[model samples]
Target: MIVIYGIKQQLTPIKAELSDVIHQCMQEVLGFPEDKRAHRFIPMEKEDFYYPGGRSEAYTVIEINMMAGRKVETQKKLIYTLFERIEEKIGILPIDIEITIKEQQSYQWGFRGMTGDEVNDLKYKVNV
Candidate 1:
């Protein structure tokens, strides 16, 4: 799953493009399927969305959650791919975007009404 946060005016209009870019990056770097897209956009007010200096209102934060086991190189590739694709395809500068990947043990995840470890049928491998 991916969670995106940005100011409403700058973020709402590009939700579709952002989701496409994110899923595309995931497919390329993470080997995810085209149909496996889970994205959440949180559009906040200007006053609510505080950002760091030197960045415009375009500043966005993306948080990706997944099961652990991917190599460091793979994770780095995902980040770089997202930055490049988002900037080129969504018109969001890499400098104005922040991305973080949060990984947890498979056993800790619950899906399909079962714990990750108990749910054995998965379309993709987690240990990439």
Candidate 2:
């Protein structure tokens, strides 16, 4: 799953486009399947969302959750891909984008009433 957080004023108008951009990056760099999109948007008020210096209201936080199997290089590619694609396609600058990938062992991931390792078929590669 990918969770996105940003000020409502900035993210509300472009949520769908931002989701598409993020998914494009994931599919290109992480080999995510087209049908496996899990995205959550958390749009907060200005008072509820605080950012650091040099970042405007466009600041966004993207948290990616997944099983731990992909190589470091692959993960790096995904981050850079998101940064580039989001800036190019969504008009969000790199400085305003904060992305973090949270990975756990396959045994820790529960889906389809079973853990990731217990699943028999996956449409995409986890080790990519």
Candidate 3:
């Protein structure tokens, strides 16, 4: 699963479009197959966010966290695709985006009270 959180000053006509653009980039990067991609958007006010040494003028930061299933080639492709989309949609010539990937075993994550075993078994049973 891939999770995305977009933080920008209160949503405006333009900023709102940015949120959608970011989400689309994420979905494409993860190869969501037109479905099964989950994401969340967290918007903040300009005054409420502090970038430290980062600038706020038409700048954005994108962070991605996911398991190691995706190949390095796929990861690079996703990042490039995201930057291309951002440039096209937001018109921000110089934007900053960062992504991080990690490897996680299936047992480490669970849904409801079931672990990976139960979920995989259920899917296998259904397919059979």
Candidate 4:
């Protein structure tokens, strides 16, 4: 799953496009399947969203959650791909985007009434 956070006024209009761009990057870098999209957007009001210096109101934070198996090089490629693709396709500059990948042991995730570690029918590989 991917959680995206940004100011409501700036993020509301581009949510779908942003999701598509992010999914494209994920598929390109991590070999994710076309049906594996899970994006959640958190659009906050300006008063509730505080950001670091030098970033504009368009600043966005993307947090990717997944199983801990991908190689470091693969993860880095995904980050770089996201930065490039988001900037090119969504018009959000690299400086305005912050991305973080959070990985956990498969046993820690639960879905389809089963833990991730027990799932044997995944359409995508996680150890890439």
| CA RMSD of each candidate after superposition | 0.8, 0.7, 5.2, 0.5
TM-score for each candidate, following the candidate numbering: 0.97, 0.98, 0.63, 0.99
Decide which is better by TM-score, 1 or 4: 4
* Candidate 1, residue 51: how far the Cα is off, in Å: 0.5
Evaluate all candidate structures by whole-model CA lDDT and list the values in order. Answer: 0.91, 0.93, 0.54, 0.97
Stretches of candidate 4 above 4 Å error?
none
Give me the overall lDDT of model 3: 0.54
Clashing pairs in 4: none
On the 0 to 100 scale, the lDDT of residue 29 in model 1 is 80
Among residues 3 or more apart in sequence or in different chains, the pairs in candidate 3 whose N, CA or C atoms overlap within 3 Å are none
Q: Write the per-residue lDDT of candidate 4 for residues 23-55, one digit (tens) a residue.
A: 999898888899999999999999999999999
Instruction: State candidate 1's TM-score.
Output: 0.97
lDDT of 1 by residue, 1-128 (tens): 89999999999999998898899888888889887898999999999999999999999999999999999999999999989999898888989999999999988998779988887777777888
- Per-residue CA lDDT of model 3 for 1-128, tens digit only, reads 44433345433435556657756765556544444444444556666555536644444555565444667777777778777876787765444444454556556667668765445533111110
Which run of 10 residues does model 3 get worst, by summed lDDT? 119-128
The all-Cα superposition gives candidate 4 an RMSD in Å to the true structure of 0.5
